[model samples]
Target: MSDRSYRFTHAITRKPAASIIAGLRAVDTGTPDLALMQAHHAAYIAALRATGATVIELDALDAYPDSVFVEDTALCLPSGAVTMRPGAPSRLGEAAEMAPHLEALYADVKRISGPDSFIEAGDILMTETEILVGRSARTNAAGIAELAALVAPWGETVREVHTPPGVLHFKTDCSLLDAETILATRRLSATGCFTGYRLIDVAEGEEAAANTIRFNDVVLMPAGFPRTRDALLAAGYDLREIGNSECAKLDGGMSCLSLRFTSKP
Candidate 1:
């Protein structure tokens, strides 16, 4: 199994902008406080850096309120990086903005050029053995096909799957814990997409905790899901809980703030 899946040496994150109050959302629970979100973003970055990984912090793009969720902009693999074509019109340009940054770090950077292709890294989960893509409103079959074609030469396998209905992204309810273990929500696990992996279901009613990220030695999860947190702790993961209430107002969470990867210059 490739440790590249989770043992990353670098990560890229964008600061949350003041315009985050205008960020897209399925339902407006409340306005996101920029100052609070920024504080949370800093904590998130600190957690990533705590793993001894170099983090590239990018300036915020006020033009795109949702630009803070950099994971949706591209897919980073040990082989190369592929710029995504987001389905949301407002987020489409965010991918292009991330391409140059990726190109500077990866020798083999590619893009999903099909006009009809629409995919987001947030809909993708890279495991030790394969790439699992959950088709969502932001990710389509064409995007998946393009991504598959782009990475096939690198010997990576792509497995198409379905995101739970109503979820913003496939990863909204699941995350890879390690080579063989996954932390997921029962609603998503019930689909049988994770049949072969050792699965840890998030505590009932704490489904939001499913979007955690296992970065190197620490598993970064959002604060406030004690039941689920305790469960992960029991499983022996080094956990760090970051405040995500502000980002959560926009349906964003732990994994959405950054693009984690290890690349050869």
Candidate 2:
């Protein structure tokens, strides 16, 4: 196995109204108002680097305005990387843009074709024993089956989790905070979603704040969500709250800001 730590490379792009479902009618719809998005992406990249992980920055794909969020369309593992066929037609270009980077990162890079199969990176959560994939509109049954076959040889089990129909994606409602624990929203559990893993509840109205990224002992979370942040801090986690107001306006939170990976031992 490779000794090098997993590194992340991402492109920061301008947010478009089409990318954000809630802000489609706003005046700043198509403008190049990427300043805040860029800053948040940069901050996430910086935080990942602080974990002593190698960081690679890919050139922006001018064709796709939302290409900066590399996680939405691909899954990278030490053995190889899988390029997903985004369920959203508007985000299809992200898979094409991510292929070259994956090819360079690992000797074996595979792709899941659409028209029959569709998978989004946000639906995949990796743990030491298995790869939990969320089955949602963005990630279909075929996609999960294909992914399971692709990673089986690597000794990784692919478990399927049912997602709430109303949720936009899985990561937004549920995320793995560590190997043993998950920070999940009630919106997800109450809907009978997340079939396979253990669910740890966040307080009412604290669902959005449940989305967190674990970097070693430190957890990166959104600012202004003090209830959840304080809960995590009191639990012995070194919580780092970052401002993501602008990104939130575009339907983005901490997880949407960047794609993170760790090399296998």
Best by lDDT: 1
Which regions of candidate 2 are displaced past 4 Å? 1-33, 190-199, 263-265
Highest-TM-score candidate: 1
- How many residue pairs clash in each candidate at the backbone level? 0, 2
Candidate 1: worst 10 consecutive residues by lDDT?
1-10
- Cα lDDT of candidate 1 equals 0.93
| Residue pairs in clash, model 1 | none
- Residue 136 Cα positional deviation in candidate 1, in Å, after optimal superposition: 0.9
TM-score of 2: 0.83
Q: What is the lDDT of residue 250 in candidate 1?
A: 91
**Model 1: runs farther than 4 Å from truth?**
none
lDDT of 2 by residue, 63-84 (tens): 6656655677777776777888
TM-scores across all candidates? 0.98, 0.83
